[model samples]
Target: MLTVYNLKMPHAVYGGENAMDNITAILKNHQAKRVALFTDGGILASGLFTLPEAAVKAAEAEYYVLSDIPPEPSYTAVQQIVDQFKENGADMIIAVGGGSVLDAAKLASVLVTDEYGVKELLDTPGRAKKCVPTILIPTTAGTGAEVTPNAIVAVPEKELKIGIVNENMIADYVILDARMVKNLPRPIAAATGVDALAHAIECYTSKKANPFSDTFALEALDLILNHILPACDDPEAMEAKNRMQIAAFYAGIAITASGTTAVHALSYPLGGKYHIAHGVSNAILLAPVMRFNAPVCEDRLAKAYDRCCHEAENRCQSDSEKAEWVIGKIEEIVRHLNIPTSLKEFGVPKEDLDGLVEAGMLVQRLLVNNMREVTPEDARNLYLEIL
Candidate 1:
């Protein structure tokens, strides 16, 4: 842990029954006449935008929809959306979708300047400042993009996804209505739920783990490990889904203080080059990376096992046993969720090992946070295992 640590959070967060109604109140408080609603076609098609739309109308605020954002979007793609948002003459932004939509909205909030765009931020993330206040409503029980000061976008030329971190990008308001994710598709729920799981475990074992992060990480682990399956497998499991939404938010808060480790570091290349979904990529790499770090993080893992498996903690005799059980439980959860555990299904070629190693090693921001050091050789072996 660092000698000094800090925590940052949104100005306000609203959740539980009728959380979307807060949107109208927020709009009235901001005294906004025009609002830009950000989302994707899938959301619009599924009518998931209804509640937010109703809230926006209730505020009597005229709004325009920007729904061109795509999954695993490139920096250029984000730039395009930001440009469009600027032309809309909107005073506030309400983003309602998955990670991609939220990230694009966050970038838009900061990139309102003509002096710099998303591409420029890749080089100097601190150059831009937030000009428009944003209300982020997550449509998935994962990603936590709503609360983070980070925005991830694919860098096409580099064939790697990069995160643009700036305190200015954090949401001014976050709405965590479980109704938004209540009917999420099984595949999406599974992938994103595991992604939250990765965030919780990774932050707990991070080299930067501190009291602020541990408080949220452990609670998030308990909530997610216990509720994720029921949340994803049962369409009517609103209670479980609500717990997952909160767990993802807590895990995301943990990330702000402690950051993620090798699993996220290595998953970027897969999303950047192979166009794999970010959550799915993390799901694929989670277990293998944790198993690699087991020796160095066994104590942390044992603690996590104790917290997450309270009912079964007596089954393990030693710290090593507890640690192994935690890892095994992760594997079991992934298997039960039906998320693919290998790159083979994605058509990732074994011959691309050298390229994958090169790209993954470049994510030093996260690699340095791993409790156990990850060398290029280790990255290659890990990728090879998945392939």
Candidate 2:
């Protein structure tokens, strides 16, 4: 019984070394005279923007950098960019940060033409649509916002991390520059690497996954399993960091097709309500959610186990043997990355558990993608177990 699904993505993408080198040519082809570059402070400090700067200047275009986007971006922040984009008449947006920055830029592009602001986009009946062309450049190997058709935004008024999911949210161009990520801090690397791992695992076991997505998901999972730890220990290893970047891209492509599951669905509340980083919030919940969903996806988890622990599998004869092997490998990866194992370690109070579950339930957009239906009880239990 195959189910119906839909997938969308970036129109053109440039990856590998000097990929940022192609930005000028992309601008020329698009005839963009003004471009808005969106990034966060971390990326601005890293100075990877120099490559894009030269390209924008070479194109003789008016460029402005908005580096105010935070890890958990709010609609207030998003609309400010939208207002600037419309008032300044900048039609081409080049997002140059991590997932939140790219998502903020994507929303700003969509809302600039409308009479409304951020609140209306979320509350209004119809607002998010393909309006302007955007080019995404990711500095983190975590959220694959570069290629996906959905943007995760914070709605502070509602105290929720809402998603603007639409085909129009896809970037017109995606530029992957490995040099940009070489300076990422160790903690950032581990958190984002876990994020990419979560993305691949969630999408592979998602209810929406199809054959096309399976290809990307398995490859991404394999790469993260093989490379993330090394990338953390040796950021100098161009080979390992490059693989992690590609893994993030592949994971992004996988989610674009198959969608993210309960881990992502449950993570939004922490980001929106508590200002937790998206990757870290997702990271803490990923293992627990997987442990919960494993039964529903035992065969899928077994296959993922096959990817990482082939030698161990030869001695296993039961599903329990394979499940333990799979869980152990995932745990080892988390240990390698040094991501916090518990939500409470990050200041999440036990009292907020109910609200988090409520928020998760309202996040119907992502919950729909879960392989198992996520009830309020299920969401609560997942959080409590992690606690």
Q: How would you encode candidate 2's per-residue C-alpha lDDT over 1-387 as one tens digit per residue?
A: 126766676788898779998999988888888888888888778878888888888887888988877776777877776776777768689888888888888887777666766677676525677677898988899799888877777888777888777677888899889887887899988888889998999999988888878889999998988888889888578899999999999999998888888898888887888877777788878878888888888888877767765464356656666766767777787876777777766677899888888888988877887878888989888888877
Q: After superposing candidate 1, which stretches have Cα over 4 Å from the reference?
A: 312-314
| TM-scores, all models, native as reference | 0.99, 0.94
Q: What is the C-alpha lDDT of each candidate?
A: 0.93, 0.82
Per residue, candidate 1 scores C-alpha lDDT tens digits across 1-387 of: 655788889999999998999999999999999999999998999899999999999999999999999887999999999999998768999999999999999999987778999999999999979899999999998998888899999998999999999989999999999889999999999999999999999999999999999999999999999999999999999999999999999999999988999999999999999999988899889999999999999989998987888674368878899999888988999999888999888898888999999999999999999989999999999999999
lDDT of 1 at 225: 93
In angstroms, the error of model 2 at 201 is: 0.6
